[model samples]
Target: MDTECMHINATLAKSGYDIRVFGVGHYCFNLIHATAIFCLLLSLSSAVGVIILLCKSRTGKSFMTWHKHERFLLYRCICDISYGFVHTLDHAHILITKDHVGPSGLCALYALLIVNTCLSEGLFSLTSALNAFLSVYFRKNVNFGNKDWKLLLLLGIGPFLIAVLVCSLGVLGPNGFFCAFDSVKGVIANAVMSTGMTSAILVALFTFYVLTWYRIYTETKKLKTQLSNNGCARSATLKSAKAMCLFVVVYIIQWTPLSIYGTWQLISDVPFGLFLAVVIMTNLSGVFSGTICLFNKSNKISVSNKDLGERTGHERKS
Candidate 1:
């Protein structure tokens, strides 16, 4: 796809089409396609696991008793599956054609799906962090309840609408072996939109997590003051704090590279490593986010089930 686009651009330029090459050459899958295949497998398996785990009802609990974090996981898994499907189809086409040029319309379709995937992932990542923030800030009262739809609208619907608009407006087109905006304005617009959105989400996550940690710190200090030697309680609080820190840390490490890649496109003459970083990081995002959410969700469900069992046992004893 990229090889064809480069030829088209070169031909257009010779014919005075005023196309400035964003960067030289097309996207090479030789080095990264295997990694991408692995990501697809990992994402699909994780998504399946999360879906199965999320559906099980524990005894007599109402549907409303579902955790807000579960909603985030559900959305994340859905997006991962969609994203993985789109990516797999695109790469499969390329591999089958031996990296030959595909139809522009098909390439546009690919671009649209890719944008949707990226935007949805970004929004949901933000939503996940926001969920954690609410969990910390509201403690036992963090239920969105009636406002859950509003949250869904902002995180899911909004991003999808924006992606559709971008696609319809032709802000995305064929790039190389994949689809992206080729024109200078299109490239700039895409860079700004992609980088700006992801960076904003990351910033929000950092801000919320920092505030959450501060709250944890204040509560821990208060506990120490009130109880003087609540050693076990303090230890548990510290562990929770560490867990929160780890969540934020993993989110940053997984997401920052893609944001960097988006921003780097605006500059000329970047190193090959930066391009490699972008491809690898962006492709592996499914693996990272899916695995992390699955791991966390499994642990949360296990804990909930254990608590439920203990309560049932106590009731029986009574």
Candidate 2:
């Protein structure tokens, strides 16, 4: 009876039941796993759905269309697909035991995570760059000939350089996980990367706000000019402005919390699972943004019209 009791205790210890049940680790792991899975599913569905919708739309004249910001939406969808694939790997690595995982698997997992991080940073930086470019591009006071290309280059390069530094310095620890530093080194390295990412996010948010204000100003001026001349153009201008504002607001809300949590995790000693959960949540921001874009009444109406046109064309040909 004692022998059986000892055997059970040893089994429990080895299985991590004792370690998991007594602390927050188990719950954290479960939460991370669940969130990651959800993110992966959401991203995949959103990406595929957007691709299909884009293909069916007559207004999608090219892969990088200027109409309705189709190019930006396509870029975001691609990023979402890549992010989903990386998080799937992250989820597998976290949920499965190391004993059951191979070295190749570990490397692939780490590589994917780093790549996703880089891409996320890059896309975010591009969003900021786009905002800056629009501000300069549309400004009445700013001369096109005098526009600062150097500043644009600097803005574009900043996040990428930071991403490169983070990836380069993020050493793989003895435990096979890539982190900021191995010990103290790892902590410092992580802090640097986290700080860089946080700074980039803040800059992006600022740029978005600036662009929103610029749009509002431009639209208000246009509205006034058109109204002074005639009222015929009022409805179209208002619709365009309303749509632009809606897009900006939805994006900011979806991405802001994730940025805040990421910045917090950089300075604090957060648990591994908790950190993973936060990252997963950040990835899910794409889902929310995609949902808003896909389900907006105007977008839905456009998609429906496109679908009907395609169906009519097919039936006529048949």
Candidate 3:
């Protein structure tokens, strides 16, 4: 009995001291490693995509006149790609230090995570703000002014400001092995970061979705009204409205599930694997959205026409 007690004590001591064994199973470790690798690959692919997009933009004249919403969406995609790269580094660090190495490196990793979270949330909030602006712009009676600009700026900055405040309160720091705080502090930090960021995203999404739907409804009504008076103009407006609605619907469907999972994880003590899966799935929304937007028929036509015009101009110059 004494020998058994001693062995148990030794096991407990080892468990406490070993960072890798801190309640994480082999499967969880493997998942983390896999996720890191996946994000790294995604980052590389996004980098290539970005390069291609830039080249296309430069060589294509029609690509230059992006509508305001398109510009916002493009910026959002760029931010997501940047965030993915940062996360790739964090995942790599976590995988490398499967066993607790030291607090120093872990702290740096945690800080990086915090920065990435901030940037990503900020960009998403901006996207929402721009969507709202687009809705207003599409209204036939609405006119832009200083008040509108101010309102737009406020909407863009509000969620990001909240995130910064939460970070300042120490809620958006770090978690897991890399967290610098004690158990209680780490829990609080996680709760703060998760709740604050998720709340911001939810608010942004709800606002954008509502505004977008309203715009689509109004535009459809106007198109119906104008169908008899001007068929071609009505058809063009309807087409644009349909495209916008489809884009929003696809965006919501792709993102909503991951957001639900994140909210659930924030409130509950879910398993690590589930959380990892949610993260992976959440990031995929950006990939899907980018792919659809970049390859849309209107976008492709504009790009092609711009390319042709650019080539003609270059030939004339030579």
Give each model's whole-structure lDDT. Answer: 0.57, 0.46, 0.47
Best by TM-score: 1
- For candidate 2, list the clashing residue pairs, or say none: 180-186, 180-190, 181-185, 181-186, 182-186
Judged by lDDT against the true structure, how good is candidate 1? 0.57
In model 2, the Cα lDDT at residue 303 comes to 20
Name the lDDT value of residue 39 in candidate 2: 74
Q: How well is each residue in 1-318 modelled by candidate 3, as lDDT tens digits?
A: 112111123333322232232324545555655665685466457645744664465565443354323443455555456556666555566667664434544544555454554445444454444434353445231232333454345434654565455445443323443332322334555444444555565566667667766765676676765634343343443334333344445445544544565467557555554556655655554565456456554454232111211222223344
Candidate 2, 1-318: lDDT as tens digits: 112111123333322222221112335445555666777788778777776676676453553223333433554566667667765665565466522224533543454354444445345444534543343344211121223344334434554455455446544221222211233234454444444555565567557667656765666676765643222233233333334334445545545554655576556544454455455655574575466566554553222111211122223344
Clashes of 2: 5
Q: Could you tally the backbone clashes for each prediction?
A: 2, 5, 0
By lDDT, the best candidate is 1
Q: Each model's TM-score, in the order given?
A: 0.72, 0.60, 0.62
Candidate 1 residue pairs in backbone clash: 2-176, 2-177
Ranking by TM-score: 1, 3, 2
Query: Which ten-residue region of model 1 has the weakest summed lDDT?
Result: 304-313
